[model samples]
Target: MQFTQLKVLAVSGSLRKSSLNRLSLESMKLLTPTGVEFLIYDKLDQLPFFNPDLKNNPTIEVLNWRKSLKQANLVIFARPEYAHGITGVIKNALNWIVSSGELLGKPISLPNLSPRASIAHAQLSEILSVMGGDILESCSPNASLITPYVIPCDTAKNLCDIAVINHRIRELWNRIETAMITK
Candidate 1:
């Protein structure tokens, strides 16, 4: 049997340069099996606010964003909740893609790095549902207490949890079984 390689497009919802959400996505990339590749979309800050007025003629950045979605076999989002909601950049990206049929029937997963992510998770879930994204069940690492505020780079406790998440992905995503079978 032959299995096609899975291309996962991982988007970090946080815009800060030191976002733990981005770090988690990077870590996920490291943990994923050989047949799966996670492409971290680092251009959130480059996208402009979504304007329904401009849907007919989007900018080059918007065009590129849509192209990325179209090329991926799966989508992954790593986010830190802000004020009980998904970050602005991510929401904006979603808005831009709303008119285009990019997210329709797409399999999207989100890894929550904040214990306070309950509301944001539900909100994003509803949004993804409306956008027609198939949210993969129990696939995200929703294990964290780190706030969306400011966390230094030297936080060991959080790092330790993140380490476990790396292992969790393999177990939950069934990459281990897939790897064993492929071998």
Candidate 2:
């Protein structure tokens, strides 16, 4: 893809302030390369439950969410798995845009914070693919950081303290840049 500027929209499924998934995205912001705009879509919790009836006139929050997705060159998601599946919060967000097709042909990176959550990762990949998103397999790394439901700390500093986690974050960004060049 040839672009004048690359805008990346990062999203976290967890609503908690101490979520490692969100912390990881924050760390990613610090390592974002120049000329790339990294924005975190933090209003997933504000979106109303997906109902087909509201397609004609969606809520303001839904409109804003779709706008961000449509405007981004890439979408990076860092979500924690729940009960061996994707969290309801992220799933609900995707459902809101499934019919609108905002993710159609968009590059998506769904990085798993917990290595044990393979089932959720696969489910998310399938959902994104069904939404017509180009799942960047190379950029989606199994960043072995936390367990399925545990929060290490409240700050990105705690998550970035581990050298391996930091490397994985940097590598994820590198893979994203490389994907942009080779797309």
Candidate 3:
């Protein structure tokens, strides 16, 4: 079998240390297919809200984050539902990239870690579409949690429901690889 290398950048909508969304990203890293590499963004909290008024010069952090996204072959967003929609932090981070058009036409995946993963999936799809992104697919694990805490190691066996989430992630990577090679 032949596989292509893909560099994927993953961003979580949650900033809390024990966020299930962040844990979902970790699970993705552990489950990535061969020839694929995943990088998780750990500083979403450091990003300032998008400001069109500060147009003359962009901050180093913002510029660097945008650069990373531009260099990535695929973008994955693991997010949670906040009051029936995506979190403000994730929305704000995306706003910063909207003007650069870095995500335009980029392949994206939105995976949810909440009990209401469907809500998160729909909300993120709308947000990404408005920003001009191409969403490859969205998946939600059956191991959704009602609370914000991380599932204990033993109980966490299903936290990511590896079978389902990994399959979707693999599919996305395959699509990304095909697009990269065909382009």
Best by TM-score: 2
CA lDDT, candidate 3, residue 140: 26
Single out the weakest 10-residue window by summed lDDT for candidate 3: 148-157
Flag clash pairs in model 2.
Answer: 1-183
Cα error, candidate 3, residue 156 (Å): 8.3
TM-score of each predicted structure versus truth: 0.81, 0.90, 0.76
Comparing 1 and 3 on TM-score, the stronger one: 1
Q: How far is candidate 1 from the true structure (C-alpha RMSD, Å)?
A: 4.8
Q: Write the per-residue lDDT of candidate 1 for residues 9-125, one digit (tens) a residue.
A: 989888765577776666566566666666999897888888888999999999999999999878888777889888898899999988688989887776666677778888888
Error of 3 at 20 (Å): 1.5
What is the per-residue lDDT of model 2 for residues 1-183, given as tens digits with 9 covering 90 to 100?
233489999999899866888888888877677788899999998999999999899999999999999999999988888999999999999999999999999999988777677899999999999999999888887744443322466677766776766777777777888888876
For model 3, residues 1-183, the per-residue Cα lDDT tens digits are: 144667889998888766766766676676666777789987777778789886457777788788888988788887777777788888878878877888888877665545556776787888788878877653322334543223433222365565555555455455556655643
lDDT of 2 at 136: 89
Q: Which ten residues in a row have the lowest lDDT in candidate 1?
A: 147-156
Q: After superposition, how far is residue 43 of candidate 3 from its true place, in Å?
A: 1.2
Per-candidate alpha-carbon RMSD to the true structure: 4.8, 3.1, 4.5
